[model samples]
Target: SHYFPEMRALLNECQFNNCLHINEPGCAIKKALEEGRIHAERYISYWNILDSFDEKY
Candidate 1:
């Protein structure tokens, strides 16, 4: 249940409750990534880790 504080804050501001932060409209996380607020490498690493977890379980 732990999440990055910056991501948590952006999620709170997202327009949708079920946003995946990928191709969703009004995604605060995407906006941050586009605006250079969040580093792309960090985000990609997070996604890779999440994908690993999904594959394991």
Candidate 2:
């Protein structure tokens, strides 16, 4: 899921080939969030879109 373009760029750093960026170990996005590489507000925005996708399907 490339809903978040910034995260997409870091996908290769994740541990899994099909990582969802949620609760997955070695999630590059999560690591970035903790290390200040990614802004918290943008991550929160991602959650909003992720929730909407749940409703859409």
Error (Å) of candidate 1 at residue 41 is 1.5
Model 2 ranges with Cα > 4 A deviation: 1-3
Number of clashing pairs per prediction, in order: 0, 0
lDDT of 2 by residue, 1-57 (tens): 476778888989999988777789988999998999888988888888888988999
Best candidate according to lDDT? 2
Note the Cα lDDT for every prediction shown: 0.78, 0.84
| Error of model 2, residue 14, in angstroms | 0.6
Model 1 spans with C-alpha error above 4 angstroms: 54-57
